[model samples]
Target: MKAFVVTLVALAVLGPQIARAEGGFKVEPSMLTDWKTVYGQVEAKDSIPARARLGGTLVELSVTEGDLVEAGQELGRVVDAKIAFQINAIDAQIAALESQMANAERELTRGEELKSRGVITTQQLDALRTQAEVVSQQLEAQRASRQVTEQQATEGAVLAPVAGRVLEVPVAKGAVVMAGESIATIAGGGFFLRLSVPERFAGTMKEGDAISIDTAAGEISGKLAKIYPLIEGGRVNADVEVADLNSEFVGARVLVKLPLAARDAILVPAEMVKTHSGLDFVIVATAQGPMERAVVPGPMTKVNGQPMMEILSGLTGGEEVLAHEH
Candidate 1:
């Protein structure tokens, strides 16, 4: 009878274990949620470097750094008074030549009339006509020189090429500048979020791709404007122009997030996945025992604001998994 009691106790203890193994394990279906890759940086859609076309000493600076300016607005002036003086001298020379040409024309007309009346020889008339022609040519040449000098004087006044706030003013009054050297920088019309993406993911990026920007102050929506053709330091640089950003976003640092298309897949908390060497896997409870399954993880998605990794392959729905160590 004692032996029979022992058998009964052993069966009772083993029955539940056998039942659990036969039924396997039950797990909740992985929830589907939106996912994105994020990056942070200060960005502007357009940056214009204002440079000088002619080298000269800066005589005046009208705008300071961060000042708002309009297209064609005079930003500063270079000391080109010498050019203006040269223009004035050329104008004076042109005026003198014009007077000389008028005198020669009058003399030529008189000489032609005298020749027609047989009062002067054809050679004298011809000489007077030739003189008038020479004077006309000289006048034209002087006018052209005056025009060139005037153009140089006009170019001395540096103007803003586009309407925007000046980001930097690198030169001060009395500073000597060279042609093509940047005097100031302006942030052009639109705002953009600058982000660097990993080269692997950057290959998927295209112009006009949608993105979201989150700043400490607020969130704004934007689209990818352009992807730089070359990669630097194993990363790709891209610009996302903000479509709905307000005035407050000026000069603010923002985080940009890019979302990819959705696919049918299982998602688990990143903490629930483990990595050994270069292999990625998860520990799932099975009917036999705890089994390690290899998994191909796609881009991570967010669930309840937590990172959830998508399982591209391996493992099925309703399987138990162990959380990764902290």
Candidate 2:
């Protein structure tokens, strides 16, 4: 009778534990939604070098590093004493040519009068007319030379080609510079986020596509400005011009999120999904027991601007999933 009672007690104790293990669900329901993919990098819209068109010693630098300058504003000047002196000399030559042309004109008039009265031969008149024409041509040539000299003098004054902050001033006052040498560097316009999309994703993106950039400062919206045709390192380069990044620093690192075609998906916290043996899965609580289901993950997305992962398959809405722990 005692043995029978012990047997009954063991059965009573084991049955509930087995039923609890099989029938009770341990996890809570996790809402699922679509997600987007993102990458991070430092980027800028454009960087242009300010070069000197004429070689000379830098005589004056009106702009300092980090100074904002407007397009066509003069930044500095090169020492152009030689060009000025040459211009002055050309003016003197032009004056001399003008005097010679006047004298030649007077001689031609005299010859014309003498020929009309038959005092001078037609040949002599013709020669005087030719001399006047030659002097006129010389004056024209001198004027042309003077114009060239003036243009060079103007070019000696360095000007900013675009409106932006000056990033660097490589040349200082009294520093000799050569033609085509960069005198300063400028970060034109405002900041932009540059992204390199994998070649596989190149066709999915286009100019004017909307993108979101997250920086240390804040999040900003931007549009794809350009997509390069050539592929390098299995990646395609693209530029994202930030329309609202007026206050952000140029070349600052930012996270860029790209949206794909819309589709229904189950969303979960990224950390909750784990990979094991090259397989991705999420632990879910079922009516029978805790279960690990295989899943395909899509790009991460934002929910109310919060980061979330898209579960492509395996889990359904209102299902309980264990929170992922580090």
Candidate 3:
């Protein structure tokens, strides 16, 4: 009789545990999503080098590093004394040509009158006409040369090539700069995130894929801007253009989550799984009783914005796991 009572107490003790596993808790198959994570940072895709078109003294510099500017805005000016002198020389040449043309015109008229009176031959009249044409050609040439010089003078004023924040000002006001040298650098066309991925995903990743970037402010949505063809150091690089990132500065670091390819993964509610001794465990109801198995967790994701954990192994979508809070 004491043995029977002891057995009854043991059954009562096991009943609750079995009942909890069977009815008190729920079990369901895990869900799956196709996504991956990659690390990267914010970068500027279009950095323009604001350069000097003509060599001269840089004057009236108005932008510094980290200053915002717009397209065609004047960043600074250059003064070339030689350009002004060239213009002055062209004006003098034009003045001389005008005087010569006037003289030639008068001579042509005199020659024509003489020929009408038979005082000079037609050959002489033709020579005077030729001199007038030559003077006209010299005047036209001088005007063309002056136009070119004037264009060079106007180009002395450095203008912003695009609308963006200025990154650097390499030249100082009143400093001498050479032609085609960068006076300032501007980050244009907005900011983008540059990501590096393992070379294995280079073939699957493509432009226009969705990407998410995490900033201090919050998470931002973005898309793949470009995929580089060349692989470097066992990885491939890509550019990501995010929405509302125009305000973001260049070289700002951000955590990026990008999808490489579709994958069939099992995900469970984050609360349903528990970690013990460095391994994940989930309770499963078996014919004998409740059982626990080790699970491999891959990544944390969201289903309809609900938090979940991805299971890499130890459970497929076909198995039902008991939901319990540890």
Candidate 1 C-alpha lDDT tens digits along 199-231: 887766778866767766576667788888899
Q: For each candidate, what TM-score against the reference?
A: 0.65, 0.65, 0.76
Which model scores highest in TM-score?
A: 3
Global CA lDDT computed for model 2: 0.70
**Global Cα lDDT for candidate 1:** 0.70
lDDT of 2 by residue, 1-326 (tens): 00000000112112111011232223222333212455645444457888898989998889878788888888888766688889889999999999999999999999999999999999999999999999999999999999998898889888888888888898888998988888888777666666777788777776887777776668777787888899999988788777766433555555787754444445665666799999998777667865788889877855444455667677655566664435
Q: Which stretches of candidate 1 lie over 4 Å from their true place?
A: 1-37, 203-210, 246-252, 260-326
Clashing pairs in 1: none
Best by lDDT: 3
Candidate 3 local lDDT, 1-326, one digit each (tens): 00000000112112111112334233234323345677777677689999998899997799999998999999999888998889989999999999999999999999999999999999999999999999999899999999999999999989999998899997788899999999899988867778888988788777887777777778888888899888899999899887777454677666787665554556665776898799889876678866888999877865446566767888765455666643
- Sum up the clashes in candidate 1: 0
TM-score (C-alpha, index-matched) for candidate 1: 0.65
Cα RMSD to native, each candidate?
Answer: 13.0, 13.0, 9.8
Candidate 2 off by > 4 Å: 1-44, 197-210, 223-229, 246-248, 258-326
- How high is the CA lDDT of each candidate model? 0.70, 0.70, 0.76
